[model samples]
Target: MTDKTIRHIGAPASGRSTRERLNPARLLSWVSGYETLVLLGVLIVVFTLTSDRFLTADNLQNVALVQAVTATMTLAVLMPLIIGEFDLSVGYLIGFLVMLEAVVAQHTSNPGIIIAAGPVVGLLVGLVNGLLTVYFKISSFIATLGVGILLSGATQGISNGKVIFENIPSSVTTLASEDFLGLSLAVWLTLLLAVVLFYVLEHTPFGRFWYAIGGSERVAYLAGVRTNRMRMTAFAAAGLIVGFAANFALAQAGSANPGYGPELLLPAYAAAFLGVATYRPGYYNVLGALVAIILLAIGFNGLSLLGVPFWVQPIFNGSVLIIAVLVARQETRQVRTG
Candidate 1:
């Protein structure tokens, strides 16, 4: 069989205009995923013109470091979205997982132990979510919202409304603080994870199955795709990613507070949603999420340097998410109608 990448190359551009025909799917694969490039360009122009500090290496590094945690969570949230499910619980789950990792490390002084157990807890939580949605026929949004509430409660209960800080060691701190090849460790990990996820979702049979399922689960099931298993596995994988993100945030903050995680959920989902509006246009993909997060990060970072209020970040994210989703929906509708 031809590789899944060729298949996901998607329908030919077939635009009515000559310009569109020049960049058909078969013609410009090398430059096809250039959404990131455009966003980067915007970043350059805006930062260079608006914020004096934005062009500095130190400011750039700070942006990368701060964005790393949100980018990680964005990728985690992308898993269920690919399968046409939304995971609202990721924010709340991160809170609990962050606290849980810190608490465990504090008691045991073993980062390895906490890291190992974090995903297991995430998996169990994901399983509960999947069971409720797939088996019990609950809407994914509602189910995940409920899970998020429960997770937040559990996190608060565990931390007793207090931040946990003293237990963090240098080892755990290195995960976020250390630089790899001059890039933040968190950003490096995000890049590596993106490549892995892209390969899995674009080149493998499972990747094709996810596309099929996302297109229409009933049809995919009829075509012999294991929709139930696929959904469950996707949710589980999302949970695992969220757990890792939780750890990254905890390490970065040098403290675990149940409040930190959910604040990021909006930007996380915004990045994922904005991703679908580019490159593949109507479909969600790994590179899209990465690019979207970078765009959002650059925009927010630049604004902050310009003395914009901190609350404006959410306004930007919320506005962008709505616009991105609307654009994606319109593209889908146009394709179907045309």
Candidate 2:
């Protein structure tokens, strides 16, 4: 039979195939392509219906404010991930920078100086991490973990296990509390950074190089990408972004605690992994990360309103991470098999 004749086999005698029109598997495949977005919509609807305050403009603005730090850190995390590396130090690094900012504020009242110091320290730490991984040939996972431990120790030593509640300038607090156009400045800053990252990752050659390296270092190197420099740069960029995030954190909390940074690690990573299931599906992107942060913030906020215990947040976050990773992997498998 001709190809055209075979194609006609599924058609009904009246020129319509009922089976094809009602195929549940095909419907499922189409829906699965936008699973994250669908889930977000469903969550929003569920929360809105179950709680009186969930869909309020005020609550949403609050969610954006609360998630700003996580969104920023997720962006920072994405850089290293793009180059096939992990900066495990990001959690403690935040604590170390916050402590440094507080200590600096105590000695000096200059907001610019206080803010600049955090990024410098972060940059230095990131460079050190990159050097260890790239030049010394150490694994990024191990190197970053060791660096994180050292940072945690240094933070404790410097703070002496005391949270720095004093010497935080009014300007520092204002940075977090100040509102513009019905939202905090921190939220605007996060949005701005997200735009910048979107442009770089989606437009620039530098971003493409990182993806290439992540795909295959040897092949990327053969294709004339600077594998070592790009990897190191990715680490350095992550540090710089983390430093920026630390400032937002300080502004929000109005103080520094030695233990605060490590706690952020799980949530930040969870958001990052969950982000893979958003927007671009198989690849990590800043917009997706921001969406994931918002989704998480909403979920936690709803739970809090429902009187769920504080410990449940971490459990929820961990579970989301595992599910997101599995979904991302399945999407990847489908892409390969399809």
Candidate 3:
């Protein structure tokens, strides 16, 4: 038979063949995966139903501003995730960066470029993390967790257990307060970064290499991909983004506290993991992370408006992360087995 005839012959059996062929499996892989679309739909339905206040201009403005820090950090997390590594240091790293910026702004004569220092410090920290994980052959989780502990101690020692209330440079402040059109500066920055990250993850050679390595390090290495370098680079990139998030958050609060970083850790991680469950269900990607962040932010924000207690936020974040990850795992397993 001709190749074309063979292709037709291999098609699924008749009743609703077209629709069945487009079953959850095919659709999931193409549309990122079912998890992502389901999350998107859920967000839309919740917003539409719960509070007319949920989708209003002001509330959306709030959502963008509120989730900016988490979203930025989520992008940072995306790289390591794609390469199948996890960096628990992001939360503590942001905390340290925020505190460092505040302290530097107060003591240094050159507070003008102090915000820029955030990313520089991040790069350095990321280098340390990468080296430990890649060169020493330490597990990424162990290395990052150790680094996180060190950072927490360093931050506390530096501040002498005091909250940093220094008057940061005006430039930093503008990042939080300034508006671009109708959105806050942070929101605009988040959107810009998201676009850049999405392009890199979807279209760039580096992104393809990262994903390849993530799918199977051994296989990717056999195919001539530099697994170690890819993993290291992913961690470093995550650190830089975490630094940006730290600076943005510090400016938003106009103060730096040692505790700020850990507060964001759960939500940041939750968002990143949840992203893996959606769009691409079994895989991690930038757009999936962004969508996860948005959905979590909407649910949390909506609950807050409905007079939910302060402690409820953690409950919501934790529960959603666990559930999303579980669902993602199940779907992924079925895909692999069937």
Tens digit of lDDT per residue, candidate 1, span 156-209?
998999999987877887888888877867778778888998889878998889
Model 2 agreement with the true structure over 1-338: per-residue lDDT tens digits: 00110111133346647886567765555655356667778888988988898899998887777777888889999999877889899999999999999989889999999989888999999999999999999999999999999999999998899989898888887878999998888888888998998888877898888888877899999999889999999999999999999999999999999888887787787788888876666677776787788778878888887778889977877776677768767876776575
* lDDT of residue 181 for candidate 1: 71
Query: Largest lDDT belongs to which candidate?
Result: 2
Residue 182 error for model 2, in Å? 1.9
Q: On residues 1-338, what C-alpha lDDT tens digit does candidate 3 reach at each position?
A: 00110011244456666777777765544443445567657776776687778768888788777777888888887778888888889889999999889888887736556787788899889888999999999999999999999999999988889987866777787888898887778888888998998778777888888888888899989989888888888888988998889778877888888787877776776778888776556678677788888878777788887778999977877777888889778767765675
Once all C-alphas are superposed, what RMSD does model 3 give against the true structure? 5.1
Q: Point out the worst 10-residue segment of candidate 2 by lDDT.
A: 1-10
How does candidate 1 fare on TM-score? Answer: 0.86
Where does candidate 3 clash, by residue pair? 28-33, 32-279, 32-280, 33-279, 35-278, 36-278, 36-279
Can you rank all candidates by TM-score, best first?
A: 2, 1, 3
Q: Which ranking of candidates, highest lDDT first?
A: 2, 1, 3
Deviation of model 2 at 132, angstroms: 0.4
